[model samples]
Target: MSSFRRHTCVAFTAAVLVIAHSAAPAMADDIPGKIAEASGILNDALDFSQPPVLPTIEAPRKTDIRASIDRGVAFLLADQNANGSWGSATRTKGLNIFAPVPGAHHAFRTATTSLCISALIELESGGLCQDVAAVAESIDKSEAWLTEHLPNLRRATSDAIYNVWGHGYSIQALVRMHGRHQADAAKQEQIVTLIKSQFDMLTRFESVDGGWGYYDFRYGGNQPTSSSISFVNGALLVAMAEARDIGVEPPKRVVDRAIAALRRQQKPDFSYLYGEYLQYQPMRGINRPGGSLGRTQCCNTALRYWGDLSITDNVAKNWLYRLYVRNGWLDIGRKRPIPHESWMQVAGYFYYFGHYYAALSMDQLPAADRAPYQSMLAKLMLDRQEADGSWWDYPLYDYHQPYGTGFALMTLKRCLPD
Candidate 1:
């Protein structure tokens, strides 16, 4: 038997034994029938059939990678709005993600702008950017727009707290800004103040259940009553950790609760639930590995960053392997227009988002261990670059290309050799 089958069978046997052990003595005679039933359920849930083997793709040359990054940077520069930000309410399609007026757009624009700023900063810092002068100018304009507008960002409506994304991503951008202006003590102090204000916004908007969520369907009060979303928590936690690295400590209670909430959603295999609301239906497709292809990387990286010892090297590597092998699960949903309209209910937005976090997870590995995955990740990003030098998965108004390119650029940056 093949190694995949061998492992599956062993897992099946162990599962059956565990089930049989919990059976009552009176039902002992029905053990065989019970085992048959258990086998069926396990097979359906695990899908133990061997996946098709994809050919090994060699890493692209460094020159090729640099060229791609330059193209992506050009896309972001060209796509920037006159106000020095990225993304607007333009380019609406038949179906669009709900963004309630100025507030939602504020959050969307802030988050997208934050991502673009981060990408430019990272590439510039790495010395891979070709247009150094232009990049610096763009970063300055974006920093001005972000610091001015981000402070006013808030929930779009009672039910939509999309600003959480803005707060989380802005913290990340601010950290980069803080680092970039180290020589200018006054500028760094202002960035630090902005970062703390974002922290306050997060605390005010944190879900009553702990962590952050974009929706507060339950109560939508000043204290949001939304369920703690796994990926949202993951993103926020990672950003908070980055802030902490710069001596900006997040609220311990908030961090602890977010971590706890994330842990609650994490399955033994590391696949996370779509949100806390889906906890009851743990077996639902959206909560399974296929549905979770985009989430596990971010979630795992968050836990590891916050000192989750259980997320060892092997665990991180296994998820990375799953991400590469089952990348089609995410790929099939790309540019689908509608959200969660693909197989396994995979949403189009998760595509670049997943790969970005996967790149971050790759960073968790030792220097020597990252090369192969870096090559693999670079191949995936390079394969998907658009003729316009941008990468977009979902059609979210005019935000997709800029945000997607931002994520792709950052992901590709991690793919570069140290």
Candidate 2:
């Protein structure tokens, strides 16, 4: 059997007790103080003299990677919606990728829009874009839409899919924008204030355990375990880290606990479970040898980017090497129907997402370790770039391409050498 198909399946067996931290809970009364406290830690751990930049790691295929980013930027510039929000292609309806989903456009629209904005900022910062003015104009329109909509989104219903993701990407875009526009003192202050407000909004919706979840439970008093997914936390955690890097201090306890919550899910081998509470259930197919691979890259990349060196040193780096070097993420032999029921099969749906995270994770490794996977990842991405300069996980519609392209560009930026 191929290495991918030969993996053993592991399931959640029991609930492991999470060590209690008195300050872990998010209480409004103490959150402001905690936000102040986070500043101390942020100042000590990160350098905020300049905007957050992707690692200056060297890749053998730097030329091709740069080309790919330029193409991606072009596609995003060409694909912006007239209203300035990038909506997922609502036209593609089906039982699989498009199962008549509720709030699909609303959630993905903001999330993807912010995602692309962040991408453009990254490209511009890295000097990959040939036309700064055009990208800036695109960002201005998108930022306008996001700013006008922030109030409603901040108070969006608990069930809204946009809660964590939309807020997470919004924070990313705003933080990057803050850094990009630092030369303008007034605009910088204004952008930073907006960034802080979004972080404050996200903090309110954090799961009881400290992780930001995609769904809010406050409305109907629903349980958090059903919606506080790990990958969503992963995305938000990285965003929080970026916010901290750019000088927007979130509540220390909230960031600390979210990291802790994610830490609690890390297995001995360093693979993270899909949900914290799911750690006690069968996990049906989300476990190892099943669908664990689907969540590995995103979860681990979050930890790695957020400075979890223990995982980076011991697990994520090595695992990514194995996954890409062996093409294990492809899971070549497990092609079967009813993909939703099988973890191995469902991984196919997240192919591009996983690869994107994989690229991010690999980018953090030391040169020696990153060398082997560098060329491999470059080829994987360059070969897949569509002629129009966008990429997608599924071909359901062109909607996914912008986000996919954004992710691809981010990955390629990390692949660039010093």
Candidate 3:
């Protein structure tokens, strides 16, 4: 192992020992059992089995990627609601995920709209879109809708904190909006104000454990008692960093606590527990490598962006390689309707979300190191586009296609040759 990887392992082992030593004392008779259990958990947490050899991937033609992006943009243009938002609570399935009334749908629409707007902004900025006029119009309409509704967004119920996703994603969109209108000082100021509001919302909804979680089943109080979920923290921190790049600093207390929470859940191999609640059950399928395939990318990127030196270029490349080689683990769960029903408890929605973050993680590497992974990601996305010109991995009311396409578009844009 490299020196950094060795240091990470030693540091994590020491932290675990400190926690154990600080715990309440046990009787002599109980010592053996406790030791055995701790040993088991530690062993599970340190599983570092070598991944299968990397497979060769061919780069797709740039023209092919351009065509795919054009189709995706066209789909978004045709799918926008009359109100200029992207998703609604329509298209119910018999086994739909629980979404409580107007609030959940409100969060969903805001998040979906924000993603669509970000995608359009990225393509327009890169000069990748064939229909620039139409794309600009869609972005303007959606940006107006988001600015109008985002401040009112909140937890759907005390138990449902899905709005955190909306808040995180909206912050990203607002950052893009801030840049897209840089020449318009008035519009940029308005976007800056909106970005600050999102930071406030994240602070308001941060889990008591430190980061954020989608569910608060523990106490359902005003201040959530949810366990900090690893990937949610990854998404939120990344967005906050983007806002910071544009002169909008997030609350330091919130950022520090979130980084701490995420670090606690990370194992020696860098596979994270699904949530802090799963800390003891580190050997569970969902917490293992195959299960962590989608999460490691985002979590690593978030930490790297926040100045975690251990997340080196090699670490980033290793995870990106795993994402491509073992992608079937995630693909099997795609469009299955039920979350975590597939092997390793992999969920369908993680498909595009994972690749999207994988693309972000790829950006952390040297420009010379990004080409192979870019080609690999582009091919994966291109192969999955639906005949309707959109991409979806799960059935999330009417929201899936829009959010999926939005993620896919941004991801593909990253794949374009620099």
Candidate 4:
């Protein structure tokens, strides 16, 4: 084993020992059966007997990718709150423990900061960002804040509709942190402990149907029904798969059951359901308008990251790319403003998030298939970057810009050649 891997194992063990008492284990006795069933169904979903061969084409990088990444990092550093998180107190005010709202700035800080950290880590990992020392400092402060605030942020509110996004992103960032610190055994171990503890926390909160829900399903009367969101499940699965790849093994049953939940909800056309019953309905047609398009980008990207090459290949050729081709991703409402399809009003809500995930999907594709999408995404993103090295989809009282910048930087990192 690599020295870092060994350190990570130790860190996980140490973290489990330290935090085991505080965490409550999930009701997982029956999960194994669910896993078995889901596995059987997923096996039938694909003809894995002949997996497609991914060609080894070299990824072509846009000349400005590195500069764009650095500017994004600078934007994040400039906007970071004194508390080390990236949120505004005014927007986060009016917090009632039970009645949390998605627009609340506090509601997004941990996740946003986590995303920034993940982006910075990716730049550092790929050696794409020029300011190495500055990047390290930015990551340290943001990571410290996240680690400290995670417990409080994990608390449930009455309107916890978008909590899963935070949890999913949090794990993704933590896993990246663990992987990037491999050269420093001590730092890697410290991050591994955080990763393990958070994974355990996440496992305890897995929805009743073997997936995660937008709400904290454990309490708040939020029970996972047939109407769960595929985006949440996909995000959790990608996080779990990445964690496992980095040698921090979550409970096998938890990972298996989550994968099973995804298989059960996946549509034959490669488009995932917005909800359990609302399969293909696009985010179950949640509050945001034109959300189906946004959800498609995130869910498919997550699926692609977890080894669904078919989704990536098809998306580049005949799927969502077609939508982007005809109707620019800039604003869907400009072309068609159906009641729920008001892209202008709501596309801003998930604009950066969607593009970030979509870029991730392209990053995993074989070079030949990845080039065109990479070029397209790079141009679209570069065109939208603000003069201050920041990006924002919706200016919702001071929270969206930094978070959006975080998402954009992460996406741009993928555009750079490894």
Candidate 5:
């Protein structure tokens, strides 16, 4: 094992971090899926969550699926630039912030970190990435930084608003590391301590009914909306997944309460109904509009139990047909008070939730129905990549694009290998 991959089984959730030169685990057989050949599969199609690319390819033959995925891998390798990013090396686009401790004004910005990480996890699972070096380097540095700094989380951020995104980044990095056998026992315990602190901090900041606002608990100022709720939900799910991975799961009641709270907040359309006086449905990127930007992930994660697949599936199906698909592909509403591009940030829920569960629901769908999703997903990655190797940051909610960029990168890395 590489030095970074040195943690043993006792280290608890240790993920291997094979530096570029280290020997790789035997590459798994090629993943079965559609290659990057098609582009217009869903550009004009309607009434579906994604373009029917991979699933359609899956029905005819498993061999074809494997081949398509291999071709896609080649495309990814071909796309990489020397600077490590798949595209340009420009400073990521971001909001400018004046930090108290900096010689330079901290540029407030991030691309879609969440999507990026999501995608990378898939590649790690598939073992097909061609240009893994650049990302591997980023992960190594980030992991070292995370391990050294996880225990210091409370110092960097205190509330959900300030630290929620940061916390999400920390969670994804840990999740990746633990899988590689890097997060040893001490690291796991430190994470546990940080989580306890974060949960308490959230509860303290939340309102009476258990919702949140811009800075902390919701009040007369700005109130909790679906988009913000989704970000928080992502953080909690990360917590739950990590806790379970480390053998220190949160109380069943705590998770249950959070879900129940989410269910109570849902409207007839399945979108979240939030705000103090005004209420509206969550849209693609609408931040604090009359309605909020609630998506399927909230419903999906909120409904999961230790072994309750039925409940989660039911929730996902209901929301997919009603709230999500019914809304046609527009941003679905006007811009709000926050400073954001609206749809760009929030619409990402479609790729992550749509694919994550779609994969789960794969065994159930007809071949034709699923292909478009795969095609659409691949197209989305190509369309969204900034020349600088990151995604555009979510406008209002995500001031720091790197975290969101991380999420986006993760997501793309999962769904599309090349």
Candidate 6:
């Protein structure tokens, strides 16, 4: 019944529509124009720092996707339980904290709720439905349920499972409607105040490098992978963005420190590494003489995603793919995994979603140049497609499906271009 469990996790956050910071409206040949062009490629589920988009570009033709998305939305709405939980989705019936597990009941909370909200938000944002605005009302009901019931099942205090994710979606949903919501300043203030308080508490636990951990935000290492760090970072970034949009200023240091911490994964060649593991300090669960884990798994994973550091360098991109081929994770082209193979599976992200990072990274390449990963992605999608047309274990497979699927679908949307 702690606070972190209360908020929703915003799903489908995507990559940069890189535009220069502008003071005023400018032409397309101007800096704003470049950003305007890039923004068109990105889905507008949520706005990045830039606004304005290109008028037209050939997008991928989705085969039956219109119907697929429509069906998915209808099924979900029809299935929503009377009590507000999706599919009687709640915490699993029993606790098996350790050991690989499977979900018993179809239930969701914190991160799970965020993802549900994300899917609904994305469809609405995409204008997939004739009554696209109804997406807002759906989100409102879901958010109300999460906000009301979080105390019963939320994690107490830790970076990983609860609080940061709670703020992430809560803030994003509110931010999406910030302009409309803020017209009632008093209500907006109350909600913003609630979110900021949680973020403040979560931020306080940040370690020296501005990274967070599942158990302790300040250097409490639970595993030797970048899973929690990157996941939490995404959530925090979303939250930070929401805060800024709402007239509340998040500490610049938060993003600064976050970027710095992320940089820890980088190698000299500009390809990023993964986690941080100090031997004698004995923080996270990683306990080995040399602690053969740092900046490997998560670094490779993020490299495949939209992180600015990984996207800018060709050498880094090649090195990452090479590492991906040679073993799994690559840091400056070095191939390796944590001692425990800890990075093998991160919950909350669908398996195909991992490649979504690769697709985003491939955006830096020409269409011909990007063919390898693109082909790989198409195959992965084919392999994983459920008989039902809806993804079988996507959201259910991970700690939160909304964000993971959102990321993957956006990548698919990008590659397919429609």
Q: What C-alpha lDDT does candidate 6 achieve relative to the native structure?
A: 0.42
Clashes of each: 0, 2, 0, 4, 71, 25
Worst 10 residues of 4 by lDDT: 1-10
Instruction: Quote the RMSD, in angstroms, for model 4.
Output: 15.7
Instruction: For residue 177, give model 3's deviation from the true position in Å.
Output: 0.3
For candidate 2, write residues 111-157 as lDDT tens digits.
78888888888888877887789988888888888877755564234
TM-scores of all models? 0.87, 0.75, 0.88, 0.72, 0.55, 0.56
Error of 6 at 212 (Å): 0.9
lDDT of all predictions: 0.85, 0.63, 0.85, 0.60, 0.38, 0.42
> Could you tell me the TM-score of candidate 1?
0.87
- lDDT tens string, model 6, 1-418? 1111121332421211111112113333435436434422223322233322322222223554454455555545554445544533333323222211111221234545555565566566666643555556666777677657543333343333344455555565555544445468776676666566656655664555575534444433432122335434544654565477567776777666765665563444333322444323332322211111222323443433425644344433443233223222111111111113222211223233344445544565566555444444443344444443344332232332333344344445444432
lDDT of 3 by residue, 64-138 (tens): 999999999999999999778998998998877777887888888888998999999999999998988988888
- 2 or 3, which is superior by lDDT? 3
The residue-by-residue lDDT of candidate 5 on 211-294, one tens digit each, is: 433333333333333223543553455455555666655556545555555555554434443332223533422322112323
Candidate 5: clashing residue pairs, number: 71
Which ranges of candidate 5 are over 4 A from the true structure? Answer: 1-122, 132-134, 154-160, 182-207, 216-231, 274-294, 305-372, 393-401, 413-418
Segments in model 4 whose C-alpha atoms lie over 4 Å from true places = 1-61, 89-107, 158-162, 216-219, 222-226, 277-291, 304-312, 326-330, 333-347
Per-residue CA lDDT of candidate 1, range 56-134, in tens?
A: 5577888889999999999999999888999999999887677789889989999999999999999999898899999
